[model samples]
Target: MSRVLRTPDARFEGLKDFPYAAHHLEVGEGLRLAYVDEGPRDAPVVLLMHGEPTWSYLYRHIIAALQDRFRVVAPDLIGFGRSDKLPEEAYYSYERHVAWMREWLERLDLRDVTLFCQDWGGLIGLRLVAALPERFARVIAANTGLPTGTGMSEGFRAWLEFSQSVPVFPVGMIVNGGAARELESAEIAAYDAPFPDESYKAAARVFPRLVPVTPEHASVAENGAAWCALERFDKPFLTAFSDRDPVTNGGERIFQARVPGTRGQPHVTLPGGHFLQEDCPDEIARLIADFAG
Candidate 1:
């Protein structure tokens, strides 16, 4: 195993509106994954999965809204938030991420889950649903998808280019750019907390390039297989896409058209940018709770 770095607890101190206690589980040798497990233990599980350059903190407001009535589990992907970071970018891969999350899910024994995933969250979470269809009761896809590399959006293309060329990966600023509204300084700093320095950003910096954008891409076959399963998924599926997210503006239509569960559902276009959780957490949380019902 490559050398891994764990962010000190001090960095996460004083984060605004994110006060949930941190829980850690070992997903790999020398790698510990951090997540927030809140609400009633017996309540139905509502899994909130975040995206690139962000972590469980991205869902704080949403968590606060749902924890009273539902069990909310939000984990920081490896290399983000309180999770252990791989020192080398090469250690991060689409398949590895899926595997890590798959193991984590099985370890937790989560069932009857209602998944709300965005960006990379969708990419991996959708695959998890496909892999363990019986575990998922429903899905709420927000500004997210499982791409089979047929086409690339212009907004995504720009982001791909920028992620590669940028010398320093500004975790917080990158998130702010993705959101419709500017994040407060403290919030932005919270996003940066996981990465004490540039070396800690290896996974974040490499995530964009790992996206499958061609037929021969590493994850294309798996994602295509996932799409096949999703086509047959008869469970409830909702698309709560945002109105201002250029990167995923029209992406929801693809899910609506392809996934059998999406038909006749009360899909909605929410107001905000890519990170709608930041712009309208309460609304999104309510929508998710209602959809899960």
Candidate 2:
């Protein structure tokens, strides 16, 4: 059995601009995934998935903006935010992340979901869409991809090197570095809140390496299979990639080229960095609202 670590409740106190109440779902034995579910339960479900080194707090502004019109559900992927964390990096893997989320989704019985995924959120969320395409109504992929062991970009290569070589994993600073604008102290602190110490950071530290950037990478075959599903996903798939994100700047081209759903969609380039949620929350919310409608 894997040992789990949960951040103290005290650490999340007084977070800036994040006022949503947390709800939990038991995903595995003794493992509870944390999420923020807002708006009317009967409303159209909008699932927001966050990416590396960030949590549901990344979607606070987006949630607030869309809650009035949609059922906004944002979950902190295991090892981030209020969710349970594994101390050992060996406990984390691309397949395991997908399994945990699959369980969470099944338990929630969320159907006809409109997914908004970024970063690793896209990596994992796209896989979920591929696995259960029937459950999703549409998709809004931003700053995320489902790599099938293809070569990575120069920016991603540098990020992989830095993540592996950096002695102290600074979660908040990493997030700020990915944003187009500087973040406030409290906002930075909220990014750092879920991680009380280095021990709570194994998943964050391991996520970059988990990206299947080379043919030898573990999830290459699985992502390839997912791509087969995505190719047939003839739903309204929109690519809302950001302009300034070096890591995934032109990444949307692949989806547009391959996914049948990209045909006739008004794909766009938003103004932000890698973490566009922090840089353009309201715009993202508006984009999602219009797209889901």
Candidate 3:
């Protein structure tokens, strides 16, 4: 049996702007992945994938804005949100995350997906798109990248070191700090809800280190393979990166230059920090909704 912990339901009680009912799926033995499935079942699927230290709650605003016209599927990756967490941190890996999401997406039979991914979301989601291009209709990348171990930024280096060495994994404060505007205490508390204590944060703590920052990194070759496929992906791709995120400020240029789909597209730079969803959800939601249409 894989040692796992499921957060108590009470921890997520009365979260601000996150009223969607929870849906669960068995991703592995004794591990159930949770997601928020809202809007009409037959509508176009808009898959919202979140990143490290934050769960689907990070996209509550975006979900609320787009659920009216699109089927919004926001999943809590294993070890985050209401999903089951592996008590042993060593079990987590970049490839494992991509595989877990592959299972989740296949089981759900999500097709014609308009993917909105950020942070680690892009790392894993982009791989899914490369491996299964026909499943996606369009893509919108924000404050995220698929790194193949070259030109790693100083800001990311500092973040990686901090994530590995921080005594207390302050999930809520980390999200707040990554936002351009300050978040309310209640909102911060909601971000903290998924992890009852530090042990549940093993996945978050390991995410920064899992990033492929060098050629020797474990996921480098796999990511390079994905990039090869992405180069040929002619589907619509948009980069709505934010202006204030030091971690990924110049990443959009690389995507636009490399990806065939980015040609002639109106790529944008929104005003916000790394977690632009929180800082500019309405604009981001509108962009996605318009792009999907």
Candidate 4:
């Protein structure tokens, strides 16, 4: 364990279009995980998992659109949003993230869940599905993949280099750069809110480097095992990738080919970039609603 930092509550004040109250669960010792729990408690759960350099705020639009029909629970990954952050980047790892979120999921006792995961969300969330396959009913993966240390994309390699070398890790600017549409100054600020200063950005800075793109990476074998579980998953998996995300342009193909649940599914390529939630939230919401129904 390392020294933990929690973003000041004042930093999150007056966020745009993100009105849901955050709920907290102690997932680790002295660690409180922040999440948005909206809609009917008894309604079917639709877990929205976000990726790097983003938080549950990334799913505000999708949560609003789906809250009326389903229980939308979106959690900020331990270091990303309202959750506790570790000042030491070394404290974060692929397996630890999965273990933390797994504890959070189990503590909530979420069942028959419909997961909508993107980016590292898929990396961690898919591992959750693989570990607790019985807890998930279906999955909607968008612009995400489970890499097994085979190879890295040119775009991802570029991102890796930029992330490690950049002097000032601009959280908001990096997010804005990934989206297809230009983010308003406020929305961009919300992304920046989680990290008031550079000290709070250890998790964000290390996330890109954590992707197991080589055999020597830590989670390679674990991701390989997770894929084996996915291959046996037959519960209606869908891939709604975007048209403009260079980093993960055709990443969905492997899931369609390997996962039995992808067969006969209407996988789509939406008009957006890596952060498609920003580009087309309503459409993504509708797709999830229809798919979950």
Q: What's the lDDT for candidate 2?
A: 0.94
Return model 3's CA RMSD, one decimal. Answer: 0.8
Candidate 1 C-alpha lDDT tens digits along 98-124: 999999999999999999999999999
- Residue-level lDDT of model 2, residues 111-136, one tens digit each, is 98999999999999999999999899
Report every candidate's CA lDDT: 0.92, 0.94, 0.92, 0.95
Winner of 1 and 2 under TM-score: 2
Instruction: Judging by TM-score, tell me the better candidate of 3 and 4.
Output: 4
Which lDDT value does model 4 have at 161? Answer: 95
Better of 1 and 3 by lDDT: 3
**Model 1 weakest lDDT span, ten residues long:** 23-32
lDDT of candidate 4 vs native? Answer: 0.95
Off by over 4 Å in 1: none
Local accuracy of candidate 4 as per-residue lDDT tens digits, 1-293 = 78889999999989999888889998877788999999999999999999998999999999999999999999999998999999899999999999999999999999999999999999999999999999999999999999988998898999999999999999999989999999999999999999989999999999998999999999999999999999999999999999999899899998999999999999999999999999999999999999999
**lDDT rank, highest first?**
4, 2, 3, 1
- Regions more than 4 Å wrong, model 4: none
lDDT of 3 by residue, 1-293 (tens): 55788899999989998898899998856579999999999999999999988999999999999888999999999999999998777899999999999999999999999999999999999999999999999999988999998858888988888888889999999999999999999999999998988889889988898899898889999999999999999999999999999898899998998999999888999989999999999999989989999
